[model samples]
Target: MDKRILVELTTEIVSAHASVNEMSREELLDEIQDVFRKLNALVGVEG
Candidate 1:
């Protein structure tokens, strides 16, 4: 999968969750990181 698609998907995931509740700066970053982590795992990305 392309990195851009991963990024867009991650953004969508985070945005969907964030839309339900207001997140602090740290929480937002954590959400983004967590989504990327899961995405990377699925893609076999070692990062």
Candidate 2:
């Protein structure tokens, strides 16, 4: 998997979720990781 795609997708997810502004740094990282995990599962890509 390309790193750019992951970054782009994560960025889009973060940008689309307004609640991120209220999250702590750890929470935001968890949210981003969750999104990547789900996306990878859907696309049959290993982490």
Best-fitting candidate, scored by TM-score: 1
What are the RMSD figures for all models against the true structure? Answer: 2.1, 2.8
Tens digits of per-residue lDDT for model 2 on 1-47? 76568768877988678454788788888888888878776665434
Using alpha carbons, what is the TM-score of model 2?
Answer: 0.66
lDDT by residue for model 1 (10-29), tens: 99999999999999999999
Error of 2 at 3 (Å): 4.7
Q: Provide the overall lDDT of each model, using Cα atoms, as 2-decimal numbers.
A: 0.89, 0.75
Pairs that clash in candidate 1: none
13 in model 2: Cα distance from truth in Å?
Answer: 0.7
User: Each prediction's TM-score against the native?
Assistant: 0.84, 0.66
Clash pairs (backbone) in predicted model 2? none
